[model samples]
Target: MSSRFRHAALVGKYQARGIQGPLEEIAQFLVRQGLDVSLERDTALNTGITDYNALTHAEMGRECDIAIVVGGDGTMLGSARQLAQFGLPLVGINQGRLGFITDVPIGHFADALAPMIAGDYEEERRTMLEGGVWRDERLIFDGFGVNDVVVSRGPTSSMIELKVTIGDEFVGNFRADGLIVASPTGSTAYALSAGGPILHPGIAAWVMAPIAPHDLSNRPIVLPDVGRISIEVAQGRDASVNFDMQGMASLLPGDRITVARSSHQVRFLHPLGWSYYATLRRKLHWNTGV
Candidate 1:
């Protein structure tokens, strides 16, 4: 039987060591499956693989039916942010420590992906956050966040002060090492480390977790995604704001970072019988009870 994905685009973490082997293997596997394969520009350049066509992100967006990303969650996050705009469905191959997004094991890629390429897979949609920084009421930087947007203190020992507001209402003035504005997809990331609640992907909410606040009373809060979240740097020597992997440092006072729901959502293809709870159990070691 022929696969629905005739043309596949492969993306990888080119900076990581020992990635060329897997890239070559996957490319060969895809080609053997009777599909035309293209390597992402940088992935091809860095890996020095010239057997297949090298395409830019824009070209892949226009040409390929689906993208197979090989890396950890960080790599998937970066690719998802860039490819989400094109409505491209993605399949992730785990190469990092934690395979939250990259659920497919490197050894089991052929087993899991063979069926998926033939249109026998579960489809999942994940929402993204899109917003920007406002300096003196002027928009400066804007980007998408597949996980979360964070505002934290710089190298100085002093904590940052952030005035939080949800839409028209003022939340509070928090003094902490930093503040995390996370989507449901990010609940298990940095937010979880900061004591934020784990929100299911089906939930349309955001988690606001403060990084080590001065007052213990300030706790992690889950809010609806309907309103825009604004975090203004009230007081801090040097602060920074990060939208997932992209960020701007050395933010001055009065720099407002506004976040809201993005119109585009990432589409992921998982092997048949895949479950969010099952993923949580395996990844979090929930089933390894004593």
Candidate 2:
């Protein structure tokens, strides 16, 4: 059996326009539950709490039993990248629209925590991707992504050309605006908008989707998680790589980017009543009463 987490850390994007209220409520809720709650410095200031340990992102991941993200999916994505290897479960409280990763609504926060504290909920382990930027055979940037890694043209020129290969098999050369290498957890983000299929979270696969492919026949392809993908920039003045929306190293012509599944996984907490399809309907507004 897995161990239960007793110390909970609260993290939020306090500078994100308006998030102070929810952060305070979550912090108070955790304290009320008798759980040890530590707040990020910015969040603590926003909540008028001063006797708190001001932790950096990495410190929060290392010290916390579980991390509670009280912002949009963007905030959750940033936190996940830092916390993935820490093996701590994360619970996201939605403060933004269409929160695929930030699953819990603000109103349901208390209800969700009830069972989570008692260890009555399930942990969903999600796969992550490790990407390396190689410039002239020298490794430049090594990073990981919980959602998707995007390669796109920078401020300078025209469309980019990318030659992709998967596990020693040449996939195709794509001439397009960009490319998205996504995990099943990220299928609903950029990949979904790029006409990529939605993959179930349990699937151990990655979706390679080309954005605005010049050839209509060159569609998104899903491959085994264990497969290694190499993307070479054939022609482009300025191209760049981003991991889970966080900008990484810039790529020039002839740069090669390799991506594969990372052995590390991230644990996410879901309330016993949480359902993926239900979140889809609520966030997507699938149906409305007449």
Strongest candidate by lDDT: 1
Name the runs in model 2 displaced over 4 angstroms. Answer: 1-4, 45-48, 288-290
lDDT per residue (tens digit) for residues 1-290 in model 2: 24566778888877776577777677788877777788866677765656556676677777788899988898888788888877878989888877988888888899887678767776788999998999899998888899998999877668899999888899788999899999998998899999999888899898999988888998998888887899999998678898887766458878989999998898888888778787778766786773
lDDT of 1 by residue, 1-290 (tens): 33488999999999999999999999999988888999999999998999999999889999999999999999999999989999999999999998888999999999999898988898889999999999989998999999999999998659989999999999899999999999999999999999999999999999999999999999999999997999999999779989995999889999999999999999988999999999999999999965
Each prediction's whole-model lDDT (CA): 0.93, 0.84
TM-score of each: 0.97, 0.93
Off by over 4 Å in 1: 1-3
State model 1's lDDT. Answer: 0.93
True-structure lDDT of candidate 2: 0.84
Best by TM-score: 1
**How well does candidate 2 score on lDDT at residue 65?**
84
Model 1: per-residue Cα lDDT at residue 261: 98
